[model samples]
Target: MKYSARLRLLAVQTGLIASLGLGFATLAYSETILTVALAANPQMQTAAKLIGNFEKKYPDIKVRFQTLPENQLRPAVLKDVATKSGQYDVVMIGAYEVPLWAQKGWIVDLSQYAKADTAWNEGDLLRPIRNLVSYKGNLFATPFYGSSSFMFYRKDLFAKAGLTMPETPTWNQVAQFAAKLDDKKAGVSGICLRGVPGWGQNLASLTTVINTFGGRWFDQKWQPALSEPESKAAINFYVNLIRQHGQPDAAKDGWQECLQLFSQGHAAMWYDDTVFAGPVLDQAGPGVKDNVGFAMAPVKATKASGWLWAWGLSIPTTSKNRDAAWKLISWLTSQEYIKLAGEKAGWGQVPPGSRTSTYQIPEYKKAVASFGDLTLQSINSADPLRPTIEPVPYSGVQYVDIPEFEQIGDFTSQQISGAISGQVTVDEAINASQKKMTDIMQDAGYIK
Candidate 1:
């Protein structure tokens, strides 16, 4: 039934009065609650500890932490983001998400927040970090832990084989050493690489390998390059190397498994993210702490094709409490928190790659010993846009930046994994990957 004008006016007045009362109740009863989405990595541990300090400073605010495996975190966060469910005030992001999601307006821009807030020293962050966490020149996120890929081996194994890791090694040398160190009879596999399928999981490592072998994912005109000589050679090399000397459960190996293999002294070498240094150096977590060795990722035509990734903190546009979220984010990612983490934990636990200052710290310098210099050098040496000796159309070293990349990467990885498992030939894997990629590219309108 339609209301008379007089009745509508009464209804409006009543509703206005009720809404005002509800708003007052909301203001009175709302506890400053912030939920954060975290990744399963060392830097996340540091961030969690810093949250304690932030809580102490602002007791009224209650912060909740949600940590997921690295592979699951991004997808979960993105789902919430796309739906505007507002489950997360802060979501940990990577280099891949910073620009793409920000462009889509899913995350808040922090340029004004940084500039207006005198307490936060945005300029104090390392330049690489500043750029990595930005989208279209606006700050989109905060770096939790930054990383580049490197080779971590067992020193004892190398010594037993009469071999030593070089500051900068080559793929040929690495393969030879991997062969010599392979002792399946002793339960020690030669090399443990991330092989289980995901964009940032195995494909990230493999992309660098392909790049160093002079591969480009696309031509300037956006043609798929998976079937090219560079990618084919790189895929064949990676598949064969892992199949012959990598972990027995190579099909199941991701970053965590590979790290476990190396940290447990079951693998001779683990080529993965530099952030892994923190856990590997932890004596409590694994048995082979003292026996571990570090080196830059092995090269071919390129001196540095190692991947660059930063697990960062970003506020979503859907958040109702922007100021409260920023307060927590600022404190957790501040310089003091970084220092505190180093002191409370170990110097090795400090977040690396994000700050040049970390390298300058005496404690970290002493702790990392051989690895610090190589890690820093690798981080500095990498130029993601031009990762290989040849130029590529992509902006990422280990990834292509299109919206379709995650699906494409996971699918390509499964195909390549079939080759590694002897279910398909390398040539067959490449052909399948090429066809899938082309179809995706065409559907996404990347190519005609």
Candidate 2:
């Protein structure tokens, strides 16, 4: 890709023109290059095609995608933007970062970019998705993939067990159903959950579980709420469930691990990101493509509960090539990308849980069957602000939207994961989380 003259000038001002030129030259022959930080996933094919098209149109500009492991992508981008390195022209981000980064003025504001580009079709994006991708009524990011939590099960096993999952199953009901379907003697575990210890990893599912069990992380006064009776009950319930029925190495399993297990017919049920359905249904990936089943996440004492997340692209304010990044971001998120994904990778492998239009498409509907509607419903029902039945000040369902939340949530999950690993008791885990959260709250001046 060819750099704009203005970009070269801006790079000179930043004393990065030499570095940028070296970076471009270092790549396979290119005078212009856009560096993108991303997370690897199956749907990236569409973006690759769009990049190919971009190179074809702007032959002078070459886009280099530096895709990281799912967990590493965000932190790498955060470091780049936070340090004002501008190493990344485009960054993959999420709901957790959109508002926070935009509010901090670390990322470029894309409101004008969206408004001026008729071809981008901001209105054509899914409503909840578009909303989650925004901060202060301005678009800061474009969703590359969005998801809500859901249940992936085995229909054949459910039928043989003479059980049917409810439209909105409860956590208790899920436990019972999983027990029935579990065939430990045959090596199948009752349920699968993410145990990977990032705040957005296990904590995503764990927070929703906490909410459904009538728990809150903080009260209106910002005091730590993890010690509440309901929260304790929730923690005990989860710790016991995993100890009693979860797969071995429960603390090591993340989305991919659970997806692999379920697809291999080792898990009776899995509670994870709805995005997992794509690989499960892909004929080339998991061998159990035809036998997979899906439903909305189980809840308790709540109308609905599911965590919302999006893997998206945001330009850092430090970027000198905002317009060029906008071009790439717009193309990646356009309706055209979805269509291309469907045509090239099959409807089942297309990105899920972001758009209303995908479900309406006959090919996609037929490819996905009943669960497509459930995925859409799950995304729509996720109310981050009203996540739990109880009132809370946070604006995220599975996540609390504070800068400190990442550290707090991850540290807290470590405490719980220790219990699941039999290194601590459930009570000890809860008490530790309570103490740490209390300290964090006090330090943040949320408590005295």
Candidate 3:
């Protein structure tokens, strides 16, 4: 062969080697992005920590989170799931939607994945939260955090007012305390409660009040009971309490609004989800962290009146990347992730009320010593199966398990909000709610 021909062949081989090397580099760096829709709350901050660690571990998989307020998050995620739009790979849902969505085939059943992975330790989940996220013995979602309602008040204010909060306060006692502590001249409302009109907003807290007042949404035969004496009394009590002592524009206030009020020293007392305690204590602002005190949710006829809830992660059936989504879900809810989050965000910010292991962690226990036991007690004591004073058909502390209850509860909340705003009398609100509930139940074939 000629010298020039040999040189040409060598150059061609070198070019081919360079092209192959570039191809392999592209393959190694290829990325798969997962979109997660989350509620804008403190839990999301913990999730962000987990996601950061997850990305480091799985470099090829990127995560993007869309955080929306609770009310908006529900409709946005539900619309995507119902329409099979595949817009979100993972969605944050509550106990209320898990069973219904699983039954309707809108979300993936996580039982198989959970069972197959011994390291996942499904048994570590608290029973009530575990059962709430399961349908027909199959898990549909994994709880990121579980919660129950409790009364949070300012120790400083109570001391200044010469008041002492009981471990388990009654509604009457709460009213008395509120009256004494109400000092509007100093820019503080006596109490703050959610009044936003949504099933999961105002009604979540209000339903517990109804239950403690010996009110049931329906009778044993699934009859509408909204206008019954107990229900009416509960509604009237809630309206009057908020109207007289709650924050200004109380009817428009929900969890976030009331949280701000209490944290900013504008409200002396608040009754809502226990999850808020972490943010209230940890936030970098003029929050009443050191002076905050917690007690069981106020009761009337019942011994324990707290409502149980969990914010969980579910993969919609429309997800094109179920396996990757499941991987992210597993990582976020795993004991390992909890530890990682604790390390990164501090034990106080570690997602609580989900795993038994979290409560067992010495650091977490020490960090949340003030509210840990109380929160766990509240969660364990909540009897969703027998939420109200009287026996009812459904099983949920703050919500009825049936799908129709969402619509019914939302409608009732609107009426109650109207009453709070003085747009309608309490009697008129209760009567309208009762009529609407009757129509809904009858149309759903629950009533004769």
The C-alpha stretches of model 2 lying farther than 4 A from their native spots are: 1-30, 283-287
Model 1 per-residue lDDT tens digits across residues 1-448: 3568879999999999999999999888678999999987876866676677778888778899998997889789999999999999999888888899999999999888888876677876777667878987889987777778899888877887899899778988989998999998889898998878788887898999999999877877788887788878998899999998888968678988887777777888889998888778774234478788888988998867678877788999999989998888777777777788888877877878776666777888898886887777777777876777666667888888777888888898898777777888989988888899889889889897
Q: Model 3 over residues 1-448: C-alpha lDDT tens digits?
A: 5999999999999999999999999988998899999998876867875686799898889999998988789989989999999999999999999999998999999999999888989989999889888899889999988999999999988998889999999999998888888899999999999988999988998899999999988889999887889987888899999999888998899998988888888888999999888877875245477899999999999999999999899999999988889889999999998888788887767777899989888888888989999999999999999998788988898899998988888898999899999999999988888899888889989987
lDDT of each: 0.83, 0.81, 0.90
> Quick one: ranking by TM-score, best first?
3, 1, 2
Report model 2's TM-score to 2 decimal places: 0.90
Q: What TM-score quantifies how close candidate 1 is to the native fold? A: 0.91
Candidate 2 local accuracy as lDDT? 0.81
For this target, which candidate reaches the highest TM-score against the unseen true structure? 3
Off by over 4 Å in 1: 1-30, 283-287
**Best-first order by lDDT:** 3, 1, 2
